[model samples]
Target: MADLIFYTNPQSRGQTVRWMLEEVGAPYDTEILGYGTSMKEEPYLSVNPMGKVPAIRHKGKVVTEVAAICCYLADAFPEARLAPPTSDRADYYRWIFFTSGPIEAAFSNKAAGWEPTPERQRMFGYGNYDLAINTLEKALTGREYIAADHFTAADLFVGANVNFMLAFNLLEPREVFVDYARRMTDRDAYRRAQEIDGRLIAEMQAQQAPQPA
Candidate 1:
């Protein structure tokens, strides 16, 4: 058996893991779980009780969640330089957690239709959706990318989040957003993952589309 076991559905955030796997050039086995099927069943839940896709069993350890998986894969395959060295741990920690935390917060709030009034904005850690997005916009504005000043798992995390944000219209399509996503998605590995899942998501949509009566 291979040392790596990937549990994923092509339709979910597992697609990001698929891209990272491609970026790092890791060889592994994949189990494509169907929707509403075995994902919640015994063996599957053993790996991730929440039954979320993109969990990985690697080198006799199990890791769940996208950020954790990205961190793990980056560290596990150091040669890939997907993440920074331990010396850069502080910034690395900040960047990854920012992706999972504040970015998610801004998008989730907007998606919920809970636009914050000035009073409400003070309580929002991200300081309103556009501000949260603008922070990144400024970060990507003058630089080629985020922390490390080179492409790393940090970009993968933040880049994917930005893509999610734009896709949902949670973030306005600023020049920064467009240029950054274009840079990140232009990677061959990223494109390959997109190609694979684009087809799968399309198929799923087709099947679910209302039929002509």
Candidate 2:
């Protein structure tokens, strides 16, 4: 049995977890679920009640949410050196939660066409899209990594989110965000994960193509 069990779809946020898994070099078994089908059904739902992708089972424990899984894996596999020391975790936790919650919420709300008014923004966890984007840009500007000078799980989460947002036009294409994402995606682990998942995505697309009569 592998040390980890990863459930995801290549098209989902599971891509981020894939990169983190490669970085950790942890032996993992992947169960790729399809959208509008197996993902909303049993078995997979048992592992993640929310029916979300990027959930993992390690050492008889289950973890969901991309950021949570990334952090958990880094700690569970200390040999990966993907986590900063406990003493220097302020930025680590800061960026992870920031991206996971506020940034995520801001972009999601924007995409859904639900712009928050002043009062709504005040009550919002992300405050507003501009604020969230500006905050992230400031945090990443002139810095190679979010947590320490060294790369950590925090970078994986933040970097992946930035990359996706920029590519999908979810976030504005500022130079700071673009440069940071470029640096993070340049990592060997990130490339390896992309290559593997890219292949899987292609395979899934092929399978779903219309069959000739």
Candidate 3:
């Protein structure tokens, strides 16, 4: 048996995990689930009550959520050097959760056209899209990686979000975002994951298309 069992959908946040998996170079089996059917039914549900993609079962333990999965995998595969050293983990953890929380909320709110008032913005983790964007840009400015001048699982999540946001127009096109996207997407592992997921998405779309008359 492979050390890990990855349950994901190519069209979902699973793309992030796929890149991390490749970066870690761990042995894992991927089970692609379809929307509304396999993903919402049992077996998969037992793995994640939320019925979310990008869940992993490793050593009979289940880990769900993209950031959690990336952090877990990095720790699981110590030799991969995907996690920062113990003493240097502040930036690693900081950026990972920052991407997952504030950045995610900011972009999502913008995409949904849900702008919050200044008073209410205080309650929101991101404050607003501009604040979130500026914070992230400042972090990435003049840096190749988010933490410790090297690539870690934190970079994987940040890179994935930037690439996804820019591609879908979910975020504005800032020089920081564009440069970071170019640098992150240029990785061999990221490219490999994209090709695999792109092919899978294409296959799914082809199957869903109507048959020729």
Candidate 4:
């Protein structure tokens, strides 16, 4: 039996865990879900009531949420050194959740064309889209990665987020984000995950084939 089972569809937040699983080097089985399919089914929904992607089952325990799955996988396989020890746990947990919380909120707002005014931005807590980008830019300005000058799980979450941001042009291709994306994507594990996801996407497209218009 594999040590872990990962449930995700390549199209969703599951891409984040797919990158993480590569980082942790854990042996896992994947049951890809199709739209309006197994994702809302009884068994899968039981695993994640929210019906989210990147859910993991390990040692008979169910774990959902993207950041939690990434953190858990890193901790489970200490050999990967994807996270810092308890000594640096403060920074570690802080940014992982930060990326998931404020970053996501701001991104969602932007995607929905809900740009916040200065006061609204402050109330929103992500410090507006520009500040959010600036905050991340400042962090990556000279640092190769997030955390205490080492590549850790925090970087995986934060870095991948920047990449996603750039994908939608939510973030300008500034030097900092670009450099960070370059650094993050250069990782072998990330490259592997990209390859797998690419192939899976291609197969998905192939399955659709062509139809008369």
Top TM-score prediction, candidate number:
2
Q: Tens digits of per-residue lDDT for model 1 on 1-213?
A: 789988898878898898898898878888877777789887888888887797999998999989999999999999998987788777677867877877788789779978778887787778777777777777677778577867898889888988877887777899888788779888999988888778877877898899999
- For residues 84-131, write the lDDT of model 3, one tens digit per residue: 889989999999999999999999989999978998988999998999
Cα displacement (Å) at residue 150, model 4: 2.0
Q: How does model 3 score by TM-score?
A: 0.96
Could you give candidate 2's per-residue lDDT for residues 127-187 as a string of tens digits?
8889999998889888878889888999889999999999989988889998999988899
Full ranking by TM-score:
2, 3, 4, 1
Q: Which stretches of candidate 2 lie over 4 Å from their true place?
A: none
Q: Which sections of candidate 1 miss by over 4 Å?
A: 115-124, 199-213
Residue runs of model 3 more than 4 Å from their true location after superposition: none
Per-residue lDDT tens digits for candidate 4, residues 21-123, read: 9988878898887768788787888988877676899989999888988888888899999888779888788778878988888788888999788766667
Backbone collision tally, model 4:
0
lDDT of 4 at 35: 66
Please give the TM-score that candidate 2 achieves against the real structure. 0.97
